[model samples]
Target: MTVEVFALGGYGEAGGRNMTAVRVDEEIVIFDCGMSLDKILIFEKDFQKATTRELRKVNAIPDDSPLKPHRSKVVAAVLSHGHLDHIGAASKILFRYQCNIFGTDFTVELVKSDLKGEERYRSETEDIKISMYAVEPGDEVQISSKLRLEFIPISHSIPGTVLPVLHTPYGAIVYACDFKFDDHQLLGYKPDYKRLKELGKEGVLLLIPESLRVKEEMKTPSEAVAREMVKDTLQFAEEESEGIIVTTFSSHIERIQTIADTAERLGRNVMLVGRSMGKYARIAEELGLLNLPPGSRVYDKPETVARGLHRANKEKEDWLLIVTGHQGEPGAVLPRIADDELPYKLTENDSIVFSSSTIPSPLNKAQMYSLDTKLRMKGVKMFKDVHVSGHAGREDHRLLLRMLQPEYILPAHGDADMLSAYAEFASQEGYEINKDVFVTFEGTKVTIPL
Candidate 1:
């Protein structure tokens, strides 16, 4: 038996570009189909000049033939989680291959929301049928004669991120992407330590782990810290202020839930704005993962939200406005409001809270500084960094390494420097440079023969 792995997208860097395939005998199993942040910012620069078709080509599969050859033999597209960096390309690639998609319940809902608009676009162009298999953590799905997949729940900012354990003929390969070890998780149950130790005892042959936070020395903080920050900022605001705006990542369902809870405590009528925010919230609530208060509203239409904010500003003392553009993305609702593009205006004591850290990208930094200047000019009270990362840090990575004890370690989902740091850590644990530890880039394939 022989198993071959290919990094179709996310290898050297992070964001929109991520595609990985494992070929075992005649069957092909895909891990993720997503785009990179690099690709999105490039396309955004010349929005009017570039079409979706063109952007798709820039991030297309390296060679369509390898995927097409065994397209019929493809058993499943197993998603590690619901993050766009992991599942965003489903709308573009689902039509190309005929396979069942397996993911956690919340991950499936999040994917459905992402593809909703794309489905309409595809329907206008061609006939497509996308079926989603929603499985919970610990549920096992046999894809082919030699492949068994299971989802092991992990603590992340999102509700249903999983560490995929693929039981192949040669050995089990665990794909650990985009996860953190939060012993003090605020919303859901804690990480399944017993299951993880059980898998560790079973003996993993290959461990593909995320290296996004490997450079950081400390373990990522828990979601509870973010809740405290939110509480402090909200309490600091004027007692009679009407507008209280908070912005964060749209996929952060836990943070959104916490925000909603805080709003209820503060006697505020919660309002969720932004296209993606409303879509994800509704899906999360439908799955019974999120429960909004009786009268909370979610609005996607900008004009309607503007009018509602105007009315709420006049009468309500506690009106929570949850929005997008936490990184100051141009034209996002928060930036638009800061620029006075919205009908409502920020008063002296109105609060604007950023429940997120500025991603370290240059473009994000510049846009955030520009937005801060604008909001400052309007005398808006801005609170920042009321958030914690969802990625495991250096100490978390060390713990995972000690638990798994895989034969081979491959650092993934990070740039060369970050991956290199991870590789160095493995060396300290006595892993050989090339024989036991492998660092690769996109288009590179690693093979194990049996």
Candidate 2:
């Protein structure tokens, strides 16, 4: 038996995230097709100059020359999770390929929401039509006569993230992407160690793992810490303040639920802002996973949010404002608020809670600092670091290495330094670097023979 793998998207490259195409005999499976916001910004500013057509090409999958002939024989396009860096470009890549797309319920919902938004941005031919198969943890999806796919639940920041196991003719290949072993997760469930152990017993020939947190020496913090941070911040905030603003990742539905519950407990009316946040919330609500309070509102238009904020401030001291722009993206709601672009002005006593960690990208750090400084100048009370990461750190990666014990290890989903760190850790464990352990780059293919 022979197996081939391609780093179609993500690799040593820091940003434009893509990965994992496996070809075994007649079956071809694509793992992920995600984009890098940092790369997109660069492409816009330098390459495309904000041209939509050029931006689409920059964001799209490379020419089908890599997988074209095998398109008819493709079995599935399996997604690891809901994060844009993992599944965001699916609509662009899979539009031409005919295959069943597989993900968890929440992941599918998120994709649907994104597809709806993409319709407005993309050409009619480039528009997405998602043919999805929703599989929960422990459920196996048969791709072809010789291959079966299983979803093993893993604890990440988002719900329904999984470690995929592909049973091929030679042996099982485990694709673990964007996950951490957070035993103290607040929503959904924990990583299924028992299932992982069972898969290990069955034999894992190759393990493709994410190296997002390889530079961090310790285990990633649990979501519980983030929850407590939110609780404490709200508990200590001035109760007499007329408006309360909380900004975080829009796709973090569990965190959104937590914030909503906190608002309810504080007797505050909830208003969700930003187009992306409102879109995801609507999809989450439609899926029955998120049924916010009857009075909870979502506003995509800035004028509507401004009016609502004004009325809420005048009407009540307790009003919860959930918004976007946690990373201080220019023109996003939070940055606009700080820049006084919003119709309503931020008052001295008002609170702005940043329930997110600034991604270490230089652009993000600079923008966040600028936004924070401006907010401080306004005398706005600020709460920061009310969040936790979803990626596994060095300790978690070590634990996974011990548990899986595959013949080969491929470090993925990070920049050169982070991937090098992960490779170094594997070397310390006596794994052969670039032999039994391989470090790959985007567009490179590795073939394993049995």
Candidate 3:
């Protein structure tokens, strides 16, 4: 008997996408049906207009062609988190496969929201149904008798991210990516070190960890640090002036919570400024993952936000604006405000804080620079990079290797440089390259030795 692993997507680069699969005998279990953004933005900005075949060609969506030979054996597809790179292509490609989709409650809601929104726009396409099941962390997910799966609680930028451990005859194949070992978290439980140690004792054949920040020498900072930073920035801004706007990733529920608390303490009424920010916050609150301050206002509709902005002008310090588009996406609230499409006014003495770092990309850099120029012309003061990454850095990576102590290691979620660095690091840590450590490219399969 042989258990095989497929590096369908996300193995070559970061931002989580495509498909990763495992095969045991005849049954197949897939993890992360994700999408990439480069080709989509470069070729076709509109997804509904682009055919799935074209999407596959541009690498916008994971090509499941590799799995077609064994498609009938596909038992299930589970998402590790709710990031777009992990779940964006689901509505586009999930219907092609017959298996059901599995995720945590928050992740399930995010996927359902995507499907529901896409259904409204895809009338020309054939009708398809998506089957989804919500599974919590610590739940045993049995795909087939040969491949048993379990969700180990983990922390990341978003809520509900987990480590997937697959049980087989040889040992367990632990899929650990897009995660951090955060014992001090604000919105979610700490990483389940207890369960991870248990997996170590049980024996792990191979370990796949996110290698995005493996070269960084420091461990990722705690969410609590960002919270304090938010509090300090808002307090300082309030003392100088009352008109302050904060932008961050919409999926970061913990960051949103910190913003809400800071606003409450400053006696400023919190007002959500974008549709996505509102939608994600509502989902988190509905799932009992967040508790927005009571009487906080949300203006998801453009017209409603315009009116709210007009009202906030009456006493700018009395209103705290939490918006989407920290990266300065054109459609985001900040860009619209800068472009004068929104009724909001950004004047001198107003504070604009970015609680996110500019993801390294030429497109992002250009867009952020444009936004920064516009705000600068208005003489607005800006604070940026007020946040920390959610990925595990070098120290944490070393700690994880020590904890799991797998016989083999696989590096993922990074580009060639990052992956190469990981291979060398793994070698230094004792795994021999090509033998114990595999720098797997997409479509490469690793067969467990019999």
Candidate 4:
């Protein structure tokens, strides 16, 4: 049997447009069709209204032309998690493949929600109907005669993240994209170390792991530590702050819960404001993944958000405002508020806490700088980087390598420097460059001998 791996996108980029495909004897399975947020921001294009051609032209979405010839051999597309960097381009690209989509429960729900916004776009073309299945962690499904897929629970910033393993005739191929060894996560499932050891013992032919943060010297801190940081930050805001506004990733339900629960303890009502805040939090609550305190509310509609902000302005001490735009993206809640487009006004006595780290990209850096300048001009107290990362760091990656001793290693989910760094680390672990440890770019394919 011949086993080949395709790096369609996200090979030389950091958390942007992640897509990979594996082929075993003419049958193929694709993983992660994501989009680049930096490209979207730099081009200022509406993601929903942008056509596939336009997105590809701007380098926003994965250019799948490399797979056009083998599209017929594709049997399934599997999503790792609900993050946009992992599953954002589903509505725009997955229609080209004649296959079912598979993801964990929350990941599937988030995708279905995103598809609703593409109703008009879908109607403009041939029927863009696709089947999606929700599988729980530890569940295995037969994809074809020679391929079986399994979902191994893993911890990350978002819920429903997993390490997808494809069992083939040669050996098992593990896709370890965007995960951390988080044991004390406040909300999501913990990493299944036992299962990973089992896979390592069973013999893994190839291991594809995310390279982001692999250069950091220490293990990534647990979400529970972040919970403490948030709690301490918000608790200190209770005495003197008139308005407390915390901004973070809308998809980070655990951080949201931490902020909400802390606000409740401070005798404040939680007000989640933003289109994405409502979309992710509401679904998480409905699915029993989040338990928001009673009397806490989500405001996404223009009218409702205006009313909510107006109310907060009147009684700023009574509300804890959770907003989007942690990366300072234009039109998101926190950025709009900094620009005075929202109803609530910032004051010298107010505090704005950022529970998210700035995503390391040029567009994001400039936008965040502008937003911080605006907020600083208003004299609001700003708190930054009050959180931890969700990707495995150097030591964590070392642990993963020790656990899964695969014959071949492909470092992904990072830029050129980061991938090279991972390759160097692998070399320290006795793997050779361009041989056992392969560094690939987007649109390139690596063939592993069976």
Best by TM-score: 4
For each candidate in the order shown, give its overall lDDT on alpha carbons: 0.78, 0.78, 0.83, 0.91
- Superposed by TM-score, candidate 2 places the C-alpha of residue 127 at a distance from the truth, in angstroms, of 9.1
Model 1, residue 298: displacement in angstroms?
A: 1.4
Which candidate ranks first by lDDT, i.e. highest? 4
Q: Where is the poorest 10-residue window by lDDT in model 4?
A: 120-129
Question: lDDT per residue, candidate 3, 1-450, as tens digits?
Answer: 867788888777666465778887788878788888555556645675566788888787877788888888988888888888888888888777888888889999998887777776676557686789898899887777777888999989899988888888788988887788787786665788888888898999888788888999888888878888888888888888758999999889999989989999988889988988888988999999989898788888777878877888777878889987788788779988888888778889799999999877677888899999999999888989889899899988988888899988878777777888899999999989888888888778887664
User: Compared with the true structure, what per-residue lDDT tens digits does model 2 show for residues 340-424?
Assistant: 7776578887888888888878888888899989999999888888888888888999888888888888888887777788889
lDDT of 4: 0.91
Error of 1 at 26 (Å): 2.6
> How do the candidates rank by lDDT, highest first?
4, 3, 2, 1
Collision count for each candidate, in order: 10, 2, 1, 0
Q: Which stretches of candidate 3 lie over 4 Å from their true place?
A: 16-18, 38-45, 48-50, 123-127
Q: Write down the worst ten-residue block by lDDT for model 1.
A: 43-52
Ten residues in sequence with the least summed lDDT for candidate 2: 44-53
Off by over 4 Å in 2: 41-53, 56-65, 120-130, 313-316
For lDDT, candidate 1 versus 3, the one ahead is: 3
Report RMSD for candidate 3.
Answer: 1.9
